[model samples]
Every structure is written in C-alpha cells, then in structure tokens.
Target: MKRYLAYYNENHCENRNYDVVIVGAGIGGLYTSLMLPKNLKIAVLSKKDIYDSDSCMAQGGIAASIQDDNRKLHVEDTINAGCYVNNLEAVNTLVDESEEAIESLIKLGVNFDRDLKGNFYRSFEGNHSIPRILHVNGDSTGKGIMDALIKEVKNAPNIEVIPNVFALDIIEEDNKCNGIVAYYKDKFVYFKSRQCVMASGGIGQLFSKTTNADILTGDGIAMAIRANVELDNMEYIQFHPTAFYSQDFDNKLFLISEAVRGEGAMLRNSSGKRFMKKYDNRMELAPRDIVARAISHEIDKSNSNCVYLDATMYNRDFLKNRFNKIYSECKNNGLQIEKDYIPVIPAEHYFMGGIKVDLYSRTNMTNLYAVGECACTGVHGANRLASNSLIEAVVFGKRAAGDISKRINYDFEDNISTINTRNNPPNKGRQEFDVDFLKLRIDLKKLMDSSVGIIRNIDKLQNALNFVDEVLFKIENLKFNSVLDAEVYNMYLVARSIIESILNTKDSIGSNYVEEYSRHSVV
Candidate 1:
C-alpha cells in the first residue's frame, strides 16, 4: 500500500497552517469545531460541498435517553444490538452523555419534533425497548441538524469550511500526526496543524447498493489504516433491512428509515405474506442485523428480487405528515405509501468497525482523533442500533473537543504554523498512466456487492480479496490525474479491510455473516 497517495514536494507547495485541521465537514467535525475554543484556528476540509456529508441524508432522528434512568436501558439495548461484544466503557460514555448531546444540538438551533404539550415525541425503532428516537421535520432529521450546524459553523470566526478538498493521507512526522495532504482546487496543498481529526464518514461507495451518500469513500479509515492506527472491528458492516427498491437514483439507494416500521409498518414476502415471524419473534421490531438477515433469507427463499413493506394501514394524512419524504418518494414511483405495499430490499447501510479510538475519541496516534463513522469506539460493537449514529457524532465530538481543550499548548502554535515556510505555489506533479477509473470503480463496487455483501462465504471472500489485490497491483504504479485515481485505491483498501476481517473472524455474528455450512460455522 502507498503510504502517501500524494506526490508533493513540500519545499515548493501551497502550504497553509492551522491550529487544528479536521478532514471532514460532517456533523462530527462541525460539532467538534463548534465545541472547540473560539481562539483556535480550525479548518474543516470537505471532499465536496460543505453540506454534502452523509449526516444531511439521515432520515431517522437521534436516539437518546431522554426519559428517567432510561440511560441504563439505552446502554443495555445498545449492547444487545451489538451482541454484547461492545466496549463497556465506551457504551457507558455514549449513554451518560446522551442528554447533554441533545441539549447541545437544541441550543445550537436544532429544532426537534415535539407534541402540543411541548414534550418531545419519541419514535420507536428496532433494538430499542421503548420509543426514544427524536426526529425533526418528520423525515428530514439529518438536514435539520446539519442546517443548524452549518449556520453555527459559518458564523464561528475560527472555523473555515473548505469544500472540494479530498484528503488523501494523514501526514505524520516522527510518529505523530501533524497535518494532512490533500488534492484541493486542482493542486496538492499541505494543511499543517498542531492537531488533526479524521471524521471522513463511511465506506458505502465500496458497494454497488448502499444507503450512503456518494461522497462517503472511506478516506479517513483508509488513511488511518495506512498510518498503522489501531482498528478494532473492521468487519462489522450494517446493512439496513429496508431500502426503497428502485433503479432511478444514482449510485446511492434511497433509504427507508427504520422509523417507518417503528410507526407500524410490516414486512411481507413476495407472496404478500408477513414473513418476519419465521425468522425472529420481534418481527419488524427486531434489531437491524436480525431484520436485514431475515430480509436476505426471505429474498432467497422466495427467489425474488425484493420484499414488501406493508404500510397500508395508515391514512393518507398520517402518512404524509409522519413520513412526508417517504410518502412522496413512493408516490413518484407509482406506489402510494398509505395504501400500497412498498417494495423494499436490504442495502449496505452503516459501518460499526473502523479506526479504533478510546472513550475520548482519540485514536492510537497522539494529537489525532477519529470521530463519527470512521472511528470504531466500540459502542456499536458488531452492529449499530437505530438512530444512534447522530447522537454518537455529537456526544463524542464534544468529548474530543473537551480533551483537546486541555491538551492543546498555545505556545507551540506560533512556530508550527511557519515551520516549513519556503513559499511558492505547488506544481502539478507528473501525470502517469490514466487507467479507466470509471470502469474500475464500477467493477469494484459490483465485486464488493457480490462477494463482501450481506451474505458471504469463505470462498467468495478469498476470491474477492484476490480480485482487490489484482486491482491494487494494476494501479500501484499508475499516476493520478484526478482524485478518482486516489479514491479507487482507498476504496480497495477498505474492501480488503472488511474482507480480511471477515476471514479472520471464524464465527458469524451481527452483520458479518458467512454461509452456515460453507467451511465457517454460524454462531
């Protein structure tokens, strides 16, 4: 693997400095920037538009222990969803700071939904014993919180949100992370800083069918792996049980939020018979891993391409108001959600394992933090519970900021800012072989979907690994013209990480499943 995907001569490059550099502009990075001291100069480098992160696409609400000592139950439910292999301390912190996280968002102008009495309406989702998921604008929870965060971030004088900057590698000198190398504005720029955080979202683009934004390319996790940072559970990828079955969208699949089922939707097989009972007792309300596996099995048993989500019991008014986005999407596709059986299929959703971090969201490397989907803090263990991702970003993002507050030495900022100052604009490095990246990316996604997808076997995993290695071998010496060249390598690294982790794990658990009788025993 190439340690640095960039070809930069630091002696003559467009170099800039900051007190802290965040490699993503998602909710985690934005919240971290907001929580940090106002005096610090922070730069949030985004791969695309500032608001293009997956956080804005989230439809379900953030989960928190709003009711009485539901904190204990929340922790229990989270652990249960992950099959009890979660880090006990990390889970405790996530639960303990639940209320504080929600309060922080509210104070920052995030308006969650509440009833006439002003009590927050807690919706139910799989794995939770009771209703605790908080939403805004019915189904636009991600956009709601992101709009508020973007406003706050823009107003904060110390934070700079730079779009169109694709972070290629974590820059380390003498075993300490000090900055990042990225492709920005058609040239390589070095962003040097005292501290750096990698919040660069999920690895969904590796699969052909995913409920993640296309911008999510696993850049953070890939760079961390190359840097030898400790990664905990790289194999625990969560596949959502219900994504709208359609081919109209781009590479991204439209997610059917778990909140739909939480509000009384039912799952049916191709024969239009409710089929979840044969798989689990909780039926539509089971944990995400259970539900996804159940759907996969049903699809196989019926030899059908999709199953049905029966939400026909609700009135049109209720459906429109409660699930306005979903209702409209279904209608546009010729299915009225209020009276039609919506076609659904399981799709790649979330990643539970990534660069390992402590309770404070600090990775193994000093002065480097990995927050959000990129950091495997172990709260989710084998699989993540519904709506916990949004809460995790803020709860731990605040902690990361708090930890940095005490550790940041203001005296060192002056010298590090101008350490390597020989100022000249960077040259576009040698453009080598231009491989067919478009075709390569398409094939890679299809390979991952077929081999490393929801259901897996030892032979398929090994074959997939070999295929990834072959692709990497082909591109190992190729030169780059666009960020896509570097992104494909990152994608392959993430796929290899997931597949290797699965091969090492002998037992089937959570979302990482292997064929029951195909050389690996199912747990």
Candidate 2:
C-alpha cells in the first residue's frame, strides 16, 4: 500500500496515498478509522464537513444487551422484528460484540448519561423489551457521540480527515478494489489504497421527504453497483413512524424520537382517539414497521395528511428533561411539547440493504469492505428494530478494522495485475449549472414518493422501474461539472436499484408492504 502511494504520487499528479481509504466521516467510518492500527496511514473522506452526516442527525439512542444472559433476548427481539428473516449468525455477532463496542466508545471519551450510582442510564425505544438503549445528553445522542469521535479522529496522527471530497467511483483491477476516484478541491484525484471501506450512509435523499441529510445521495451504493458488487433487499426501506409534519416540501424532516413514544406518548387520530390498539397490542411501543404501517392506514382511513402524537399527558418537567432537543425543535417550529399535539407522519428513514457482506463486513470484491447503512449483512433483514442501526455500525466498523489489520501486509502483486484501471480526468471547461437537471431531480423524487414509497404493488413497482430506466439513460448522457450533477446521477442509479429490487420481491413483509401480498400473513 505504501509503495502504491509513492508510485501514484510520483507518476500521477495526486495528493497522497493511504493504507486504507474510508468514504464517509460518519460514526462507522470514524470508528473504523480509529480502530485501525495507528502505524498505518488512513484517509477519511467526507462529502461535506464531518458533522454533515445522517449519523450526527440521529436522535434515538444506541441499543445493547447490558445484562448478563440477556443476549438471547436481544437477538430474539431483533429477529422477531425483522420478521424472522434475519441472518442468525450476523445478528448474534452484533449482539455479542455490542458491549465491547460501547466500552470502546466510552474509552474514546464518549460521555454517555449515567446515574448517581455511576451506571449508564439506558432509555427504552420502540420494540426494545428492556431499557437498554444508551443515550447521552438526552435526545442529542448522535451529536454527543459525533463530537467525541470527531475529536478523537482529529487527534489521531495517522488518520487524514479530508472534507468536501466526493468519491465518484471505486478503482478496481482483477476484481480487487485498489482505491477511489474522487472530486476534491476542484480536481479529480485518484486516492490509492490497499483496502477501501464504503461507510457512506443510506439512500434516503432519493425520496421527496426524508430524515436523512442532503449529502446522502447513495454514492457508495451506486459506485458498488457499477463495480458489479452484490446487493440485497433494497426494497426494505424503513419509514419512521413519527416525523414532525411541517407541510413543507423539504428533504430534512425533524424526527420525533421513538424515545418519546417509549415514554408513554399516545398515537391519536384526527378525532383525538387512540388508534394503535386496532393494529397491534403493543400500541406505540410496537416495532417501527407496524407503527409506520398503522399510522399510514389511519391517515388513509381518515382522509388526513397526518396524525397526532400526544405527549402532553406526561409531566412537563419530565418531558423537558428527557427530550430537550425535541422540545426545543418543536418550540422553534411553533409547537410546545407539553401543550400542543405534535402533527406527525411517516417518512423514509432507514435503508436495511446495500452491498452484501459477511460476518467480517467484507464485500465479495476483495480488498473492499462496507459497514453502516450501506452494507447489508442481513442483520436487519426485512426491518430494523429501533436503535439497532448505531450499534450495528459500531460493531461492524470495529470488525472490519480488525480483519483489515490482520492482512495489511499481505502481498497483492497478483491481484494488482488483474485490475482494469480507468481514469476520470478533471473537467477542463467550466460547465454552467443546468436548470433542467434540477427539475429532473425533483421529478425523480416525486416519482419515488408516489410510486415506490411506503405502500407498493406490482403495477406501482413496474411504473417506478420504467421511470427510473428512462431517467437513468438520460443521466448517462449528461456531463458533470458540479457536485450536484454527480449527486443527481447517483440518485438515478440508487432509485433504479431500489425499484429493481422491489419489482423482484414478491412478498409483503416488514416495512415493504406489497398490496398483492397484503393478505398473506407475515411470520
């Protein structure tokens, strides 16, 4: 890896080389970078600043089985929530390693909330049988964890943090990933590395309304597809049960944390009547797929755009203390947590599938790994239990680091010879931003929201696939000069992949509800 770096720097006009290249500065990428051997050079790339990621926007806590012998229960809950389609081995790996992951975070200076007795304060979330979801600063869990990890990453001498770098594609030779081709600092740069990890979060931006950050345009998934990497279960998009409905057409939606529901909030219809009992006995505490589907059904029956989450029944002081971030956000939006009924609706929240990987988080392509939301290890299966995402990221991130460290010195001369290299040269002439491209992107989002959203059927899936095919062809002919152009192209690829996956899947399970299979019972 060091030799490749020197060769690239001397032969091609490039910045530098690294032993490992991690795309995305979120929790998974940062954790993996921190876990790697300190002697090896690593580069962490971010599309924007480090803080601009879905990981930092997460408000829910991280789940773990803290009690002795409770790992069985945790695994059971996860598999049950996934409709029994979860990979048992991968789920066990996640649950078994969760304690160590939390300890690693704490050792890295993460200040999780604790009680007077010095035990960690764990909160409950939807589908969690116990109060094992660890948080920090109340509802500001993601921000707290991100701040600590960013600090540690900056202090690590061996890791190079590069911001505003958009990875366009992975450079492959002989079925091995060598590095990435990225646009950075107004030039196309080739970053050579022996191992490449794709932790670039989800594909939520493909929808019209989502809780994901604007930068998540599915670049990692698209690049992987172009490289012929295997993908799985793209149809299982989790719609968060309660995103604050602002009635505005925007991608960024304020998430009303499931912690609020866990604390006894009621899901009420427009007539001020509780309705979740009609769907499931667990009510608001049910898993996300059930809650989201129930909420959607309620909205359809009442002919309303949204429902209400009534948390006012709780003590005012308790509400404020437990969810200060949510309280402040609601107040800023002209609603009071203790007085007004929060208008909420389901929105695209989590992607349970991406480049398929194994127990070690290694993709089929050699020298390549994927962790976080971009990798489908089959732990999530058809639906992700609440708060499992963060823990999965941390656990697999560490696993990927450990596996790479064991083979960092392995000879790759034969693999290097089998690679077919392609160069993406920097743009010479300045290309003006095209308004038509912006309109096309908007149209694509609307199409996904209407045809490929929460509820689907064969006809709808086919229509979505057709639209994606047409738009993708047009996108291939367009030239890119700005990050938005590349992002739009990636969005097209992501949308097509998702639609294709949905069309191939014939059953309704978990978050993916196809009308034809609606009568078939799940699990």
Best by TM-score: 1
lDDT scores for all predictions?
A: 0.86, 0.85
Relative to the true structure, candidate 2 reaches a TM of: 0.93
Candidate 2: regions farther than 4 A off:
1-15, 410-435, 520-523
In model 2, the worst 10-residue window by lDDT is 1-10
Can you give the TM-score per candidate against the true fold?
0.95, 0.93
Residue 122, candidate 2: how far off, in angstroms?
Answer: 1.7
On residues 1-523, what C-alpha lDDT tens digit does candidate 2 reach at each position? 0011222232343545789999999999999999999988999999999999999988889998775638988998899899999999999999999999889999998898899999888877887787888998889889889999999999999999999998877778678888887778876678878899999999888988899998888999989987888998888999999999987757779899999998889999999999988788888988898898888888988999899999998767888888998998888889887889999999899999898999989999999999999999999988999999999999999999999999776555434332133442223332344547788788888898888878887887787788878776655644555678778888888888888887777778898888888874321
Question: Model 2 misses residue 324 by how many Å?
Answer: 0.6
lDDT of 1 by residue, 410-452 (tens): 8874444432322322334433766898898999899988988
Residue 141: error of model 2 in Å? 1.1
Give the top-scoring candidate (lDDT): 1
